[model samples]
Target: MMLPSDFELHRPATVGEAVALRAELGEAAALYAGGTELLLAMKLGVLDYEHLIDLKRIAGLRGVTCAGGELRIGAAVTHRELETHPDVVRELPGLAALERAVANVRVRAAGTLAGNLAFAEPHADPPALLVALGARVVLVGGEGSRELALEDFLVGAYETELGEDELIEAIVVPVGAPGAVYRKFQVLERPAVGVAAVGNLVGGVFDGAPTVVVGAVDERPVRVGAEMLDGAALDDEGAFAALAEAAAEAVEPVDDLSGSEDYKRHLTGVLAKRAVQALGDV
Candidate 1:
């Protein structure tokens, strides 16, 4: 990789300052969290900016905690931090496991969840799982803050609803959805297709209305309801096959180095079945 072209840098001590700077510089400025994604894209000549505003210096933009019955994760919180944090372990164990499965040790060490989501990488892991877990994103701009559902925040491949002057402040996930599972099919550590299934455990069995999301095969996660699984038919192999086919047909997989569109569609069914089975609602 080569160095990106010259650009100015600013370290903001507060999120307000970061938003203000972005507003002041307009499209020339980029609010940077970890730079793991931004810098790499710049090196690839896919993205460029004249100014970088570092969010790491902001005091309250890092950490994991619980309040008001939701797990509040700061935008600057790295994957490695979430992977091992005690609070994350107790509150969102499925997410912790997913974090462990991120690219590798070095990427986990440097990558932030907010950065991961904001980049809106079609092949990334967090968005599907977060969407299944009913997560919400907190975005801040000069106008103050607004919260939007994770699925709504994501618009399409490499695109999002994040305003030019807005920065992700935090991600909030609902508590007590213990039966959550993440499963993925990857080649060379990059996910080809991923599935996340989550639901409440009622009386030792998963609730009937589980949320199932398929990712990496499409621009964003595509959710399939448990109704498609058919509780009575879940016991039959043919029924499960039908369910898998339905999920595969639901996504718009693209051809890439990881696999062809057909291969991703096949993986989507296989992984979605495995993920939901892991959650035991099947």
Candidate 2:
């Protein structure tokens, strides 16, 4: 393995210790969750860190539980765990679908939910699902712990609100928000041109006016509000059209090797329609 220059490694047993170490090291240090993203960035020279804090060995940071009518997932929980966990499948099938839809089985086995969110790759799938679920990220740092809505935590491509000393501790997702559905469109077996879409439905109506989020198109996930649907009924045609319009208006996707802006825009409609249709069936 190729190691970056000026590299130092530290394993902290507690979140408090990790935060203190990060503060001492300042920007020269980076947190290592699963090394799925950080390792790649280091190889590409996109990241420069003199110290690496390993959080995997930390106790009480890798479990799933339900409390206060919400699901709490520790940051260290891997995609494979989420995919196979019976509780997750029963509570949030959309999340399980998104987890399975991530890059291959190997990536799922090693990749952490917090790592994926922290990477903030436009092409990643988890962020969109979490946003649609109205999840909250818990952070621990030198300034003490704080909780931020998933939307507020993610700012732009490869950017987040996490302070240098802050590390995500867990994610809290409210239960009974709405029944949700997720859909993704990929090219061959490569990364998706368009990732997943989640829809939360209420008593014959869209919950909280419904929410639609698209990923892998831009820096961060694009969230579409129910108002964008213009009060369309949750019927097949109405739900489909609403999602289509929201996808187009909500995202400002860029052209890349996967496809063009126009192509992605069109997929926003295509996938949105599929997602709405799926919701209607359930």
Candidate 3:
């Protein structure tokens, strides 16, 4: 990888200062936390910002805490933290498993959860489960802060709803969902297909309005409709097929190193069935 254009770096110790610098510099500036994504883009010459506002020096933005019925994950929380933190492992072991399976150890050590979501990489691992978990992201800007559903926050591949002056604050997930399961098919660094299901147990099966999110096969993580299986389930005749087909139909995949659009669409169904089944197993 070669270096991109030169840029000035500003280390800000407060969110206000970081947002202010971003607002002042406009689109020429970007808020930097873990450089895992931004640095790669810079190296590829896809992004070249004139000013980089480093947010690591800011306080109160690097830990995990639970309060008021939600797990508040700081924007700077690394994948390793999600994998090894005692609270994460104990309270949401399924989610911990998902984080553990995220790229390589080095990337896990350096990549922030917020960075991954904000970058909105098509093949990234977190979005599928985050959507299934009913996660919400808080965004801070020069004007004020506001929250958005994780699904809405992720607008498309390499894109988010974030404004030039905005910086992600934290990702918040509901405390207790019935049972959540994440499953994926990957050839190398990035997932080719990923599916996650979070459900509420009603009458010994996931009949409640369970969330099913499919990722990597499209521009963004897609919420698979489960209305076909509302009362029916994996064990029921035609139920699994309907559910899988619905999931596969929901995505419009772009062919790349992962596979062809047809192959990815097929995997979407396979992974969707397996993931929803795993929810029952758990």
Candidate 4:
């Protein structure tokens, strides 16, 4: 199908060029990553861009590596790539799980991690997982480059801290620190609730406090803090209940055709418990 009448396309070979084009076009231009989300929006008439800056050809933005004991994934790294990456599977199993849990084979092959986070949809799976792992996002823009915690980067549904001319560069996640798990409840392959938990044990006792994050039910991934689990023991029952309550209290879910607000909250609790159980407390 043909795009809307107002759409224009530009392919920039360099990040500098892209930023400059964005600056020149201002609100008239939109960055095109994988075009997975943007194209859909265009088709829906939610977005009308006169210029679409294509970032696909940019160099050095589609690889993964381990550096300084952290996994550095380029912004353009596709979901399929992350799913099959040996380092991701071994070091960040939760992230790999989240990647695999996305829509399906074709979408995974085309969708980019940065694109997913940049779109900042409320139901996206990766943000919650990344926040649970305490990841950081590197952004480049006309002014320069900077890094922001993934937790702070996602402000709300379909919203982010990105400027008009800014682009996500990479994501950095700590490696070899803890065992992690992701639990997702999807209705017919569409996720209704997703929870991610990471655990570290010290001297045969749980240490470093578990990180729990709830996704798909709210505008942004809700992080469950250690204090929320204070009264609960590290065992399965205690951890599960605490984390579930934390997730339930973290956000007010929107009511949609898929489910009701109350239903989403219930699923949040259920997924939270499953995530905790998957992290070995059980």
lDDT of 2 by residue, 216-239 (tens): 777777776656433455664755
Q: In candidate 2, which residue ranges exceed 4 Å CA deviation?
A: 1-3, 188-208, 228-239
lDDT of each: 0.86, 0.78, 0.87, 0.81
- Pairs of residues at least 3 apart in sequence or in different chains that clash in candidate 1: none
What's the distance in Å from true for residue 105, model 4?
1.3
Per-residue lDDT of model 3, residues 1-282, tens digit only? 889799999998888888888889998887788889999999999999998888877876789997787888999899999999887887788889999999989999988899999888988889999888889999999789999999999888898999878999999998776788999999978899999988865655656656899988888888898876676655865877988899889999977888999998899999988888777777
User: Could you estimate the TM-score for every candidate?
Assistant: 0.94, 0.90, 0.95, 0.91
The candidate 4 region of ten consecutive residues with least summed lDDT is 227-236
Candidate achieving higher lDDT, 3 or 4? 3
lDDT, candidate 2, at 102: 80
- For model 2, the local distance difference test gives 0.78
Candidate 3 lDDT for residue 53: 85
Global fold similarity of model 3 (TM-score): 0.95
Off by over 4 Å in 1: 200-206, 230-234
Task: Name the candidate that leads on TM-score.
Answer: 3
Candidate 4: where are CA atoms >4 Å away? 202-205, 228-239
